[model samples]
Target: TVFLTTHFMDEAQALADRLAIIADGMIVATGSADELIGAGSTNTRIRFRLPETSQLPDTFEARRDISAWELETDTPTRTLHELTEWALGTETELLDLEVTRRSLEDVYLQLTAEAAEP
Candidate 1:
């Protein structure tokens, strides 16, 4: 397994076979995107035909206090729950609700962030 430090999340995911994440010098998490997402990150991005688009804010403003926006999450189930709950509360109707898993990039960013700390 090769561990590379990268600011671009996509680069790390493309290069890695398996991901190992350590934060604060502790083993925070480890797994393939599939494994982690399968274990939970199953969320649906609901797009409603509101006759106009309300561009959702970035993670910083949206999920700052949630584990989903944290450096890493051990179990994505709780995080996924939080994401859906937040989404439902924000919008009126949820259409095109496609249940999704974590992207390789998201997973890689977490791993890289963890690997970067001194």
Candidate 2:
């Protein structure tokens, strides 16, 4: 048996086969990385950069910084497909496109925040 304690979520995720999140001396949640991340969320983050002159779809409320846009949605695959189709149709290149799932650190913060609520 091995026992480890650390405040770093990355370290915990790297070393532990099972994880337990404790807050205020109470074990608030326990699960593997995948389980914990999927426990309370289905949203995926999509980020991309487009030409400054290009227009985004009206349905997408992207938080824009310069030419980069970031948004979260549950249907990432479909969104990616739509973006691809749109790009092809408009003859625009999707620069720096990235898709990211919620990380262990995100899960930890969410669980801790919920545990703190009364």
Candidate 3:
């Protein structure tokens, strides 16, 4: 058995054959990706197509702390709800304002990375 710890969340996700995380060195969560993803939450990616493809307001929902949002939800429905709201709010002159499920890779990248690390 390998007893290990890492500062990189990606590293934690990668080497985590069966992950057990401790926020303050105290066990807080434990599970595989699916288990953790299911048990914890997920984010949604809102992809929008503006009227001119440039008219898309870069601003996100400030009140929701969703200006360019990246937050976790207890269920997939939660993300969908926020996505719908976002789309409706932006559909005034936009086309294809839709929400997509945030992939595991997406979360991994967002949580601890900007670009892929080597």
Q: Pick the candidate with the highest lDDT.
A: 2
When sorted by TM-score, best at the front, the candidate numbers are: 2, 3, 1
**Error in Å for residue 15 of model 2:** 1.5
Q: Can you rank all candidates by lDDT, best first?
A: 2, 3, 1
Off by over 4 Å in 3: 41-63, 66-118
Write model 3 residue lDDT over 51-117, tens digit each, in one string: 4433333444322222233334445475556555665785644345455655544544443342333
Ten contiguous residues minimizing lDDT sum, candidate 1: 63-72
**Local accuracy of candidate 1 as per-residue lDDT tens digits, 1-117:** 446765554665677666655555666666764564444343222222221344344661333222122223443466446556755787634344333446655555555575776
CA displacement after TM-score superposition, residue 22 of candidate 1 (Å): 2.6
Candidate 2 lDDT, tens digit per residue, 1-118? Answer: 6989999999999999999999878999998888887776655888999887888887776778865888777789998888889889999988899999878888888889988899
Residue 104 alpha-carbon offset, candidate 3, angstroms: 8.2
Q: Cα lDDT for residue 35, model 2?
A: 84
lDDT, candidate 1, residue 113?
Answer: 75
- Candidate with more favorable, higher TM-score: 2 or 3: 2
What TM-score quantifies how close candidate 1 is to the native fold?
Answer: 0.41
